[model samples]
Target: MKECVLLVFLALCSAKPLFRPSYMTLKNMMLKDMEDEGDGDGDVDNSLFPTREPINSFFPFDLSPTCPFGCQCYSRVVHCSDLGLSSVPSNIPLDTRMVDLQNNKIKEIKENDFKGLTSLYALILNNNKLTKIHPKAFQTTKKLRRLYLSHNQLNEIPLNLPKSLAELRIHDNKVKKIQKETFKGMNALHVLEMSANPLDNNGIEPGAFEGLTVFHVRIAEAKLTSIPKELPSTLLELHLDYNKISNVELEDFKRYKDLQRLGLGNNRITDIENGSLANIPRIREIHLEHNKLKKIPSGLQELKYLQIIFLHSNSITKVGVNDFCPTVPKMKKSLYSAISLFQNPMKYWEIQPATFRCVLSRLSVQLGNFRK
Candidate 1:
């Protein structure tokens, strides 16, 4: 009886950790590891680095999203720019809103790269050597709004763009022709920039921008000799500077009746047909500097909203009094805030004071000698 009692005492001593003395079960506490930045000591006592919580080991929940390799994530924004990555990294968070991948060497975007990113909005991939993008790369990204593909080696615009895209910048590429279905369902797109391409007059097909309601369009520094008349009529601003345009015809801006700002500077424009400015009654600012015009464009006085005009660095030799101001001096909605005509061959003294009667102030006009 003494030997059996001693054996029972040893068993009870070994089983003390399984239960309390009152026959109650004890819950075990859990500790999670923390990430380090390689510095040994962070604080004075290093106690604030990681804390031990009293969370039970039974319940588990992954609170934070997994960040991709070599990328920084905060507030649902992933910044992977300038990382010299050749391809898209794996395991991007599903709740990512913006992914900045600019200044990398990524050549191609695969189909399933952005498969599960449902909440992605903006994707910046500028300054890369991208040449191709799989048609279904952005298929799963339904809520994507902005996409930047500038400074790439793309031969043409990528296909299968999302319908919710609002902004697209594909400038400085080798695109020469744009088909009619390039922006077929992009009705939400309002801003489009495709400058420094090899596009010309016949490169853009008819109805190329038919389905789009873009408000701003820029195709500067290209091979355009004449204005593209097939652009959307709802344009508010149009920029086509640094091109090879030689003249402006009457029908060049007939469709752009709602245009507010027009940029045609740094071109070879020698003349603008009479009544061409009547097409845009809402015109507020016009840029025609560095051209070859001999005189100011006609029908400027009829523009009720005309406020600024840049005609510097041209071959203009004269400035008429009725060029910008009306003869009747009627009530106008907007007056000229700035009229730049410097670097022209015309003499400032030759221009009459009545030429600037509708200007805002004496400091509104800019005049200088053309030192050829």
Candidate 2:
């Protein structure tokens, strides 16, 4: 038994190669094992571990006006109207700036409706059957300016508006109220046309105009009872016509020192406060037509540049000619100076029309010659 044990120990020591771990052998064995596992699973889960794949960045497809039938295709006019499209095109080129998908049968706007068009500026989805604009549906277009969502079935305004908006026309929809912060971060918003839709005044917050930096802004038919804060400081024109704005505080027009024209036509404004037009130094024209004013505010002496004051169809019964004499010479100096008191019961002054025409003709010639 001792001899047999000695022979077995010698056999083990003298084996072909002692069982030892080698760095190269272990690496090769590991690679073989990985290959065997990959082959066993048919490489289905190989992507579970990360591996680099070549990315082709250039767009390979051609945009050769292959829009649907009855659609006009010019440079960027994708007039898919009346073609029965279900949604907007998702695979448009990144450089697409204009899209006119109006008058279509689109009912829903999913997330993939507008996927990659980054340079799109004008999105005209008017006259469509859009019931809902999905949240973040307008995410990729960083340069969207003018959006026409009129004549749709949208009950509320979509959130996350693009920043580059300049003109928005969403009229003739089912929007009930102007949501608070609806105009947030819209710095360059200039024209907002929300007419024909009912807007509740209580939903409009005080700082709604905080992000806009407009010079002349108009909400032609918005239901506003009072002016909000941070109105454009350099407001050259304001059109608040066809609304229920009745109150005009002294501080409303005080900050608009350089206002050139104001339109309060077709509103419920009854009384203008004292010194309301005092601080507006450059106000040249005003439209007070179709208001509820029983008496004119007592501060015409402060308007040094008053031109055309339209008081047509108001409830004033009498006139004060003394308010006219002071503002005449200033109008005579300016080319854009005139007063429209038609449809009002105010007594007319004896200013000669021929003299006014002669002055305007001479000024027109001089202005035209100066422009040349």
Identify the leading candidate in terms of TM-score. Answer: 1
Tell me model 2's lDDT, rounded to 2 decimals.
Answer: 0.65
TM-score of each: 0.83, 0.68
Q: How well is each residue in 223-267 modelled by candidate 2, as lDDT tens digits?
A: 677764456575777777788889678888876888888888898
Residue pairs with backbone overlap in model 1:
none
Q: In model 2, which regions exceed 4 Å deviation?
A: 1-66, 82-86, 90-94, 230-234, 325-337, 347-372
Compute the lDDT of residue 183 as modeled in candidate 1: 93
Give per-residue lDDT, candidate 2, residue 346.
43
The per-prediction tally of clashing pairs is 0, 1
TM for candidate 2 is 0.68
Query: Candidate 2 — worst ten consecutive residues by lDDT sum?
Result: 363-372
The lDDT of model 1 is: 0.87
lDDT of each: 0.87, 0.65
